[model samples]
Target: MKPGEFAGKTAVITGAGRGIGEALAKTLCREGMHVVAGDIKKESVERWKESFPEQEILAVSCDVTKAEDCEALVQTALDRFGQLDYVISNAGILHSGAVDEIDPAVWKQVIEVNLYGTFHMIRAAAPVMKAQRHGVIVSMNSKSGKKGSYKSSAYAASKFGALGLVQSAALELAEYQVRVNAICPGNLMDSPLWTEGENALGIQYARNRGITTEECRAMYDRQVPLGRTCRYEDISNVLLFLLSDDSGYITGQALNVTGGFEMR
Candidate 1:
């Protein structure tokens, strides 16, 4: 799409406090779209609000796992921007553990945040998009959603369910001119999701494999044909296309942005 096509548009993005969500919000705002940046952490949201002009972004403390919070996010977009033109369901958590060894509670938490969270966002945004008879929805899926991963049952399962949800939602919302799709990104090594701390996937995977996080990162980098890990801009570019008028004919599909790491 042209640079100005997104100007004056409004988008609601969950998990927008950091990582890929933050990247997307920044990119969209730079392109002139008003953004509602929602995150579970109040401080993160405040940071985002302070980063941009008040007219360009609205940062809200939101937990996508809660239906009410999801509703409030969309309402904030409408109240502040006067319309909601796009929804990006980027809120998710990662857990790496063998199916047999992982606690059921952990599995439940992953599903609750990743799968149910996507559902809540969609549930709240669908009516608004349908009423307007125009909108786009993009969910941040993962390569694991399309293929099996070592010691990633919980994360994979949640992403798999999320993809299915996007497919069904696409079919249901097609008549309303609201397109729903997903972007399955490869490893984003620089993101907090991988580099944060003990809870980070890289650290967890390294522990499970009896290796160093750096070693694990190198292994993944080699797996990608591009010889590098995914950057926030890589996913953001694809998301921009999916949400723009350029991809108006696309829907009910999960596009891969994995540097050819996954091809089926």
Candidate 2:
């Protein structure tokens, strides 16, 4: 992005506590945007407050599953910055298990956090953007959104629904100049989302595929034509474009950053 292009602009980002959300928050902050970073975890948001004192970032406690909390997140941004330039719906969750093995509640939880959460934020922010007649909203989607995930049916379903929401919302908000789009990123093997915890996705995938974690990780790497896992910078570069006037004519697109792992 050009220097000062997003300077002085205000953005509200969900799931800002860790992983891709945290990475995106750092990128926007470095670009001189006022960031209202939120997460369901209060401690995570507090950590953000302590970590980025020099930057114009406001940490908020937001649970995307709750409509009221989503509204409050937007309200806080408007109250503090007075205008919302961007909304990044990056908060999401996933679980991997066979169709019959996974509990119904767990499946619903994924939908709630990944799909309903996106709706809540868009619903909350749409009016504000409409009133202003300008704004951009980007949802952190996944390549699973384009195809099914191995042993992760719930996650794929949620992302599929989110892409649908992005398209429908884009059409509805187009007259107001409020763009809605999604980023369908490939597997981010190095991200904490897949690498952390004993029950990390890498481990789960390996178990499901009857292989070792390293083998499972290597298998995915080979699937990508680029021969590498997705990177935070890859998504950020596309994000910067989506948030900039360079992509002003684009909306409702679920851009695939999959390195040819998925194509339709």
Candidate 3:
């Protein structure tokens, strides 16, 4: 599609500091949409502002886990652009722990950030979208959400919660012409949720499989039929469609952007 399909549209994307979120923001901006990008990291927010100074993009500091922050994010979008056309709840975190070994604290953190975070964004954005009588919402999910994983108790649970939220919101928002859907990506190479923090999980995965850390990483990639990890654009392309008129009839569905990894 040519750029500017969203020329007069305004959008808000949470957890847009880096990776897939960043990719989505850039794609929307390139498409001529006014974008408000939110992230928990101050540095990342500032960096985005500097990187795309020419685009109609605003970078805001926000913690998706907090209701107040979510409200503020919506307000910022409306205040700056006058209306919200698209809302993407892309903020999330991952915690790798076996069902028996996972700590409650870690489990709660995942739920708070992934599940509750998506709820807060949707709850706040829906009213504005309904009032306007036209809007699109896309939530970031995972292949794990559709299937089980070896050490993804918290992550999977959070994503499953997202599916429920999408369905409920779709039913309620239909009359207002606000469509809600989800994008489930698999094995992205550079998502902080997967590659950052908690080195212990990788070590544990290797130990469980009786292999090296390198082998564990390799094993994960080998499972993908594409024979390589996905880049953020691989997921962004699907998201762009879901947000555009191309997906006008799609709602309450979690489209898989996995590299043939999770066949339904």
Candidate 4:
């Protein structure tokens, strides 16, 4: 779609504190849309508010894991813009470990944050969109959702559940002019979600396989036929398309932005 088509539109993006969520929010704001940027951390929301003081952006703290917080997120958008045009269920967390050794608490935490978080966001937005009879919902899934990983039982399962939500919600919301879809990306660099613990996990894997950290990273790229890793912009391009009227015909589909890492 041409730029500024979203000028008067309003968007609600969960997990907008950092990484892909932050990038998506900035892009939409640049496109002239009023944005309700929600994150669990009040500081992160405040940081965004300060960074883009010129734009019509509302920053709020929202924990997607809580149903009430999800309700407040939708309310914030309506209170600010008087309507909602798009919703991005982008809040997520990752926990990687072998199935046998993974702690139950860790597994439950991943599901709660990633899977249930998506559900809560959608549940809160559906009624608002249905009442208006027009809306778009884009979910941030992962390539791991498409296939199992060596040591990512919880992470993979959570993402898989997210895709399920995307597909099911798409079918149910279609008649209401509410489009729902998902984007599955592979290993993004410099994302806030990739904590030092994740790095250590990679390093440990590298050591076990007798390869350097660089090699380990490269090994991941090699899995993708595209012969390269994806950057933040790569994912953003897809999200922009999905949110725009250009993708109005698209729904109930999960687009892969994984550089051919996982093909259907």
Rank order (by lDDT, best first):
2, 1, 4, 3
Candidate that scores best on TM-score: 2
Write one digit per residue (lDDT tens) for candidate 2, span 1-264. Answer: 466899999999999988899899988898889999999995786776666678868888899999999999999999998999999999999987889899999999999999999999999999999999999999999988998877799999999999999999999999999999999999999998788998888887888789998999999899899899999999999999999989999999999998888875
lDDT of each: 0.91, 0.92, 0.86, 0.86
In model 4, which runs have C-alpha deviations exceeding 4 angstroms? 195-210
Model 2 clash pairs are none
lDDT of 2 at 10: 94
TM-scores of the candidates in the order shown: 0.96, 0.96, 0.92, 0.93
TM-score: model 4 vs. ground truth: 0.93
Better of 1 and 3 by TM-score: 1
TM-score of 1: 0.96
Q: Which pairs of residues clash in candidate 3, taking residues 3 or more apart in a chain or in different chains?
A: none
**What is the C-alpha lDDT profile of model 4 across 1-264, one tens digit per residue?**
875688889999999988788888888888888999889985786776677778878888898889999999999889888999999998888767789999999999999989999999999999999999999999999888899877889989999889999999988999999999999998874455542554555566678799987887878778778887778889888998998889989999989998877886
After aligning candidate 2 to the native by TM-score, how far in Å is the CA of 225 from where it should be? Answer: 0.5
* Top model number, lDDT: 2
User: Per-residue CA lDDT of candidate 3, range 1-264, in tens?
Assistant: 455687878989998888788888888887788989999984686686676778767888899999999999999988988999999999988768789999999999999999999999999998999999999999999887898776788999899988999999999998998999998988775455456655655566677789986887888889898887778788778888888888888899998877798876
